[model samples]
Structures are given as C-alpha cells and as structure tokens.
Target: MLLNDRVCVITGAASARGIGKATARLFATYGARIAVLDLDAGQAEEAARDIGPGHIGLACNVTDRAACDRAAEEIVARLGRIDVLVNNAGITQPLKIMEIAPENYDAVTDVNLRGTLYMSQAVIPGMRGQGSGAIVCMSSVSAQRGGGIFGGPHYSAAKGGVLGLAKAMARELGPDGIRVNSVTPGLIQTDITGGKLTPELKVEIAKGIPLGRLGVADDVAKACLFLASDLSAYITGAVIDVNGGMLI
Candidate 1:
C-alpha cells in the first residue's frame, strides 16, 4: 500500500469508464481515502459510493475558482489533510483549426487548462503548510504529437498549456516539498462514445501503435499512481508518457 492512510483528491472522476475514475479506484485500493469531485453532484456521489466506504464525492466545476477553493476546504476539513491531487478534470473537441468556433475553443480551453490551474491553486496552500504533497496533471499525446485520434488543434493547444503549467508549478513548488508532474496519455479506450469505436477503426489505430493495442483507462491510471506514490518521490517537473511508444 504505497498510499496507505493518505488522502487523495481526484477531479472529473464521475464517468464510469473514464481515466479519473479508474485512478480513484486504484488509489482507494492502495489504502488511501479518496475524494471524487465532478461537475455532476449526483454522479460524483454515486461514483464515490461505488468505490466503497471511507470515500466522498463533491460537485465541483473546475473552471470556477470559488468552487475549487470550497472543495479544497471541505476535503481538508473532513479528511484532515490532502496528500495528493490529481488534476484530471478535462474536456476535448474533435475539430480542425478553422472548424473551431469561439464557443468550442472556450469550452475546450476552459476545462482542460483553466480547470487544472484552478484546482491546483485550491490545493497548494495545504500542501505547502504540510511540507509534502504530490500533484499529477493530465496531459495528452496530442499535445506532444500536435493531434490525437479524437482531439483537434484547440485540444492540443489546451493540453500543451497544461504541460507548461505543470512544469512551472513543479519548479516553483519543489522547494516547498510539493511535487508536480504530468501524464501524457495516448488514445485511451473509455466509455466516451458508448463503445462506438468500430472494430475496423480499432484495428487501424492499433496498427500505428507499437504496443499493438489501444490504451485503457487503467494504463494511464497506473502511471498516475506511480507519480502520486512514494515510488517517484525524487521526481518532479517530469512528464511521464503513457502512450505505449506512440511517438516512437
């Protein structure tokens, strides 16, 4: 139990098959108390319940700073202190540069970039005072490769911003005993489209990946667990690629 008796907060963790939820479950099994935050109140509570006892869920719109602050306070008040934060709240859009409307750009950037910032801000003070903490930010292979299987130019730009923000935070917060790192996942198969990926499309995508398969939510979650646990205690400002040699 690498995270035994620790308290962890995971954002955007409501979806039954999303990476955030998988991370939450993995952390919980490691003996950590989990705080599952999502935009949907009911879903958040339900997800937490699904994780079993000694966990909680809260409704939080990560794009809203006030909501982020409140969530942080509430978690600390109940769980005593936050030892890890997974900034996993994000959204993506599948559109070209010219096809991206103003609304589309705003929605994608706000949730992926702004949400990460707000949530981090909410947790830093406690981590700083405690003199130790870990933060795992979620990026995407799209940011590194300039495009992903389902995201557009705007999505890439947003995730790229996340990479920069995580690195900068890691550098600034290292002295305070807080580690900040990122996970860049490739195309992960989730319930995003309700199993709409045709078998032919899956085969075509797998052909390009050296691993001969698409990624699952658990693959990225395991990377996050490594970063969040003591295994990577000496690492910070690093970007762990969970893309299965997609770039190679």
Candidate 2:
C-alpha cells in the first residue's frame, strides 16, 4: 500500500497489455484511486472498471491541449487533487531517416514529446497547489541507442527530447516539491511491439539481452512504481533504464 489513497493519473492506459495499464493495475493494488486516460472513452472507462470501484477512467487526447486541460479539470473536481502524472501516451513508426516525412515526424513527435509537455502542463497547477507530486515520463532505449527495432529516427528524436524535458522540469519544479523522472524501457512485450516481434525474432533479441529474455510490461511498470512511490522520494531529474542490460 505504498500509494495509499493517492490520486494518480496515467495517460494511454487503456491498452490491454500496455505498460500504462500494467502500471495502473499495480498502482491500484497499492491503494491508488486511479484515473486511466486514453483516446477512447469507452475503453478508458472499461479499463477503470476492471481495476475496481472508486477509480475512474477519462478520455484524453494528449495531443490536444484543450482535451488535456479538460481532463485535468474534471479529475481535480472529482478526485480532489493530482498526486502523480504518468505521461505514457505515445506512438512509433518504422522508417529510415530519408523515409521520414514531415507528417511522420509530426505524428511521432507530437504524441511522444508534445503530448508529454501538454499533459504535464495540465497537471502542474494542481501539484503546485498541493506542494508535492510525481511526474514520470516514458522515454525509450531507442532514444539512448539512437535506433530501435521498430521506431524510426523520428521516434528516437522525440523520446530524446522527452529526456531533456523531464530533466528541465525536474530542476524547475524541485523547489515546488515535484519530482520528475524518465523510464527508458527496452523491447518490452506490449501490444505496440508484440505485433512486430515474432517468436523467432524474440528469441534472437533475447540472446542479446543479458537477462536472457525480452522485457515484459511489468518490468517497466515496476520501475515506474519505484519512481512514483516514496521509494524514490529524493530521486529526480534521473532516467531509469529498464533495458535488461541491453545498453551495457
């Protein structure tokens, strides 16, 4: 019960096997009244119901500033205050550097980077009001390694920007009692990447990882839990790599 009665809002949390949803489920077990946010209202609400009563789901297009603002307002009005904000709404595309078009760049960067900015903006006021909060941004190993199996150059650039944003926000918000951090996960078996990685491919990828297996959603979720909870009370402006030693 590390997060007992905490009001946590997580974006892009409705997916069946996504890291966001995994985090939501794990957080709920620890006594958080969760706000599961997604682009689809029905899915978001359903995801909340699956967690149990008292928690709620919200429809939020992280790319839309107005939508993000509205969602934040409703959560505050209903849930009372925002204690944790997980900027997890993101998308990736596979394309080479030359293959990246203006629209491709916009689609990837807008969700991964712009959405992070907007959602954090939407919650900072409440966190400031409470004089305490935790904001966890979802970056990727792709950002650190310069390329990934699925993400294009644009994706790497977007996530790298996320790291910079989180560090800057952590510095600016530390005095306000807000801690900001980033989680960079490697080859997690989620809905987003599952469709692309075949059994044979997964085995091949696992061989490179020192853990001898590909990462699961919960691996990243556990890292997020540490960052979100008091376990990391003094930790901020940092990046936790849940890459199973892929980088090393």
Highest lDDT: which candidate? 2
Over the full model, what C-alpha lDDT does candidate 2 score relative to the true structure?
0.96
Tens digit of per-residue lDDT, candidate 1, span 19-109: 9999999999999999999999999999999998989999999999999999999999998999999999888877988999999999999
Model 1 local distance difference test score: 0.94
| Residue 198 of model 2, lDDT score | 86
| lDDT of each residue in 151-235, candidate 2, tens digit only | 9999999999999999999999999999999999999999889998889999999999999999999999899899999999999
- True lDDT of residue 175, candidate 1: 99
User: Which runs of model 1 end up more than 4 angstroms from their true locations?
Assistant: 193-196
